[model samples]
Structures are given as C-alpha cells and as structure tokens.
Target: MRSDIVPVLELGAYAAHIPYHMTWAHEQLPYTPEHERFLELECISDILEHLL
Candidate 1:
C-alpha cells in the first residue's frame, strides 16, 4: 500500500477498514472532534448523505 497506493495515487487512504489504518490517517489529519462525535451518533450512509 505504501509503494503502490501512496506513491501511485498520491492520495493517502481517507477511510480504512482496519482500525490501525484509520488511527494513522487521523493522526496525519487535523483533529475533528465534531466529526468523530457525529460518526458515533449517525449511520455511515446517513453521514455520507450529509457529506455528499
């Protein structure tokens, strides 16, 4: 993933199924406490609908 995904696409994984990967991405990103709280409150589809 580091070689093919990171270098090839140049866009790091935004959302990963593995908890470790999600934690890593969140580390690189700016802290969003509200988003995290929303995720806990809403379904993924509902959250995506709000986003999309």
Candidate 2:
C-alpha cells in the first residue's frame, strides 16, 4: 500500500487472518475463478484457526 493509503495487512505466527483487498471500478471488472476460490480459502482458514 502507498504511504498515503490505509495499510491492509497482518503478519505474525498464529496470527492468522485474512486481509481485505477489494477494488472498485467504473468499468467492468475481470477476475478468475481461482482467485475467488483462493480468497474463500483464506477466510475459511482464518476462521478455523480463530476457532481452534
């Protein structure tokens, strides 16, 4: 992230958490299925670790 923008990241062992990284556009957006699945897995893993 730029110094002018808000930081969006977490770093630590056992500090598992998904960092939000969204984008907005005036035109249409393009994304691959693999990217979506990866995002889901990250959230799921974070939740699982939090619960355990």
Candidate 3:
C-alpha cells in the first residue's frame, strides 16, 4: 500500500491509489513526438466515471 493513502484510511475514509500504465509528459523531460499520440486519450475520464 502507498504511504500517502495510510492517513486517509486511518481517518476511516476511503482511498484508492490507482497506477496508470502510461508515463505522462514531465516538465523535466523533453517533449517527444510520440507523446502527442496520447494527448487526446480519454482513459482518465473513463476511470474517473467509475471511481466517482
């Protein structure tokens, strides 16, 4: 389990730590041409719908 989620669980509230398979663009990394391919992906929205 993630340490960050421990506090929420201690408070008796629900928490989840979902890991994404994709690596999103980072400020420190150079922008690659291939990153554009995932720019329009809607996977997060789909995940949020289920989580919410």
**Candidate 2 residue 41 C-alpha distance from true site, Å:** 6.6
Error in Å for residue 51 of model 3:
6.1
Clash count of each predicted structure: 0, 0, 0
- Judge candidate 1 at residue 9 and give its lDDT: 29
lDDT of candidate 2 over 1-52, digit per residue (tens):
1221212222211222243465434222253222211223356555664356
Per-residue accuracy of model 3 over 8-49 as CA lDDT, tens digit each:
555666554444555444422342123211222335565465
Candidate order (TM-score): 3, 2, 1
Q: Estimate candidate 2's alpha-carbon lDDT, on a 0 to 1 scale.
A: 0.32
Q: Which portions of model 3 show Cα errors greater than 4 Å?
A: 20-52
Q: Which ten residues in a row have the lowest lDDT in candidate 2?
A: 1-10
RMSD of each: 8.8, 8.9, 12.4
lDDT of 1 at 49: 51
TM-score of 1: 0.18
- Write down the lDDT of every candidate, Cα atoms only: 0.32, 0.32, 0.41
Per-residue lDDT of model 1, residues 1-52, tens digit only: 1222223223432431112334444244343323221232234455565468
